[model samples]
Target: MRWDGVHIAATGVWLPGRLSAEEAVAAGAYDADEHAANRIVSVAAAETEADGGPSAPEMAVRAARTALRRAGAAAERVSAVFHSHVWFQGADMWTPASYVADRTAGSGVPAFGLQQSCNAGVSSLELGARHLEVGGAVLLTTADRFSGPSFDRWRCERGLVYGDAGTALVLSSVGGFARLLSTSTAVDNSLEAISRPASPVADPSEARRPLDLSALADDYVRANGDPRRLTLRTAQVADASVRQALADADTRMEDVSRVVLNATGRSRMRWQLELQLGLNEKMSNWEFCSEAGHLGAGDHFAGLDDLVRSGQVLPGDRVLLVGGGTGYSCTSAVVEITESAHRPE
Candidate 1:
């Protein structure tokens, strides 16, 4: 949908640290061949909370604080807070969004949490843009910590490596750094089974089993026939979503200065988006993403932060952010930088 009054006021990202792929291989936590195939050099890994490190919510708060400061928005100025995540955030049956709101944007801001897999960040941005009124501001945050006993970041997925990080974006109706031109989403519900648990939902034991995305995808492909056909369809849908977003923004593909895509893998990135959209690797944030791994829903947000901080995105530059979630959902957004922010050191 086209947006008239929405702007990306500021963005912030908080990464714990990086764990090299070589280190993972040396520790027998990852396969060297697979790491070479994925072409991911490193991944952001969070330190244990026992080391005085921040938890998921705490990380989100840190990012939010930075974003709010950059936007020059006080806690009371924020109208809402939306937190997105891919895994558990410390506690069970608890609301991390409320905690984030209380710490950053203050109370009674209608804070809430959402899970649309990796698409949650962009999805929340879309929702927040639509919810914003004149002069109102919305705080969007995404965070995830993929540790042991629940998830093995390096080996959980086939061609993708998960990372631990928190990202925040302050969206406001008041003018700011970049204008949110448009956002679009497309879904293929039939592909949802590709990530579904092997066991029944009634059994929670299935959740404890080390996540095997490769096995799940293989089973789904075998049952559905032709894996190549499924891949083609995904690429087509993603292309269509991006095209629609560009159209809504009244821009052409060639007009985009940068593209932020999911940090899946080099091969998948080439086949899925770059090839389908006729974009070169230079137009995408592959170098930064390769080091960070997939920051769940925060990939696009973090990419935006990198682009702005590195001064690759300047005033009047148009940027495309695309994301695909495990629930077989795809989303795209077009952003136009209206003002250049100070580059980070």
Candidate 2:
């Protein structure tokens, strides 16, 4: 009745209607030709689709199925599911996890949802790693739709950098990729002053509503009070979380090789890490988030995909994941690339 080593077996991702960085810039939403842009970025605008329902569960199910299929694992093999949806794709109704389970091909599996905002992926990963007592492959899904309610609200730097995305990662009971050596999530609630400043539809008294995209363009203009302060505080905790998670994993900063930071833009990401993580020396960023914009909960998982694709993560290579969510939660995870994960491109 104990969770041993938690390993990532496979990863699956779904990008919205594809858009190039050039398109994003031309659209006046972002600048693709910006200096120091990661050559690896190709923006994706996740278009809302009819999946029998407009719900986070539907989006997550699509992603989960893809990831599990890539891993060659049946839905029934999934012992648990962790679903993270930051923005309200669906209105406040029931927890989206239940719908995912109901739609999951597997007849009887359990799923839980976490509200760590951008850090939801890593937080969910940590949860699956601990649910070893459940004793089965854990399929984690992170799916978010930032466009709805802010579809055209890109006038702001933060909103402009947002893109729609969904990612699925599977962890095996026997362990797969790199074991979840340890995890650290730090929250500076005092700095909760910053935010995208949108009203959430979650009604504690009512079942979660279905996904609504009518307000997509409206929410983006709702800028938070202090973007600068929020960014600064985010970097602060990211730095501390890195050190703490590294220590917990029994590893050292010097020993760490690759780092995946999913901050929205290159400039903001660079500033955050340097001023916060204290990495003024040298480092490589997969930078998937920039061109794609911020993919809500999918940032870290999607970033990991970039790391692997860019060859930053080869078998036996150690990679670090750092997440800075809106709630001011900082999370870090150490991952090792596995041969199986080095799937044929």
**Model 2: runs farther than 4 Å from truth?**
1-4, 20-42, 50-56, 72-76, 105-107, 148-153, 156-160, 196-233, 278-282, 309-311
Q: Please give, for residues 142-207, the per-residue lDDT of candidate 2 as tens digits.
A: 877655444442433332355677778887765555556677878887644344224544654442
lDDT for 205 (candidate 2) = 42
TM-score of 1: 0.96
Summing lDDT over every window of 10 consecutive residues in candidate 1, give the lowest-scoring window: 197-206
lDDT of 2: 0.65
Segments in model 1 whose C-alpha atoms lie over 4 Å from true places: 74-76, 206-208
TM-scores of the candidates in the order shown: 0.96, 0.78
Could you tally the backbone clashes for each prediction? 0, 23
* Cα misplacement distance, residue 114 of candidate 2 (Å): 1.6
Candidate 1, residues 1-345, lDDT tens digits: the string is 999988898898999889998889999999887888888989999887887777888889989988888887433478899999998899988999999999988877889899899988988878998778546899999998888767889888888899999999999987789999999998887778888755547756646467678878888888889998988877777877888999999999999999999888787777655568888888988899789999999999999999998889899999999988877888999999988886653
